[model samples]
Target: MESNILVIYTGGTIGMIQDPATEALTPFNFDALYKHIPILQNFNCRIDSYCFDPLIDSSNMNPSFWIKLAKV
Candidate 1:
């Protein structure tokens, strides 16, 4: 049987990379996540991802965010 999994990335060090030009941290190319994490392809299932539009920092987490996350 095939399975479906949803991956939600809420902005963090895990989703960041160092910018070679500026030597600063920035959001990594989410589209290339599967390419970077090839282990995902090992699963016989469909994978999907969801990212926050504005991308919230962990320090700014709030109840509304939890609600929105729950909805997703």
Candidate 2:
């Protein structure tokens, strides 16, 4: 059977990348996810991602965030 994995990106250091031009860290655009993480292509199962709008910081997570996460 095929497996399905949902990668929930809640915005944190894990999704930050350094801008080569300015040397400043910025949020990575999930649209180019494969380019940044080629290893994902090796996975046999189907992998999908869901990024929270406005990207919540880990330090700022609250009950509302948990509710939203649970609904997903």
TM-score against native, each model = 0.78, 0.83
Residues 1-72, candidate 2: write the lDDT tens digits: 778888888999998899999999888887777788889888788777788898999999999899999998
**What digit string (tens of lDDT, one per residue) describes model 1 on residues 1-72?**
989988888888887889999999988777777797899888899888888888888999999999999999
Ten-residue region with minimum lDDT total, candidate 1: 28-37
Distance from true location, Cα of 40 in model 1, Å: 2.2
Name the TM-score of candidate 2.
Answer: 0.83
TM for candidate 1 is: 0.78
Candidate 2: lDDT of 48? 77
Per-residue lDDT, model 1, residue 4, is 92
The alpha-carbon RMSD values of the candidates against the true structure, listed in the order shown, are: 1.7, 1.4
Give the least accurate 10-residue stretch of model 2, judged by summed lDDT: 28-37
- Number of the predicted model whose lDDT against the real structure is largest: 2
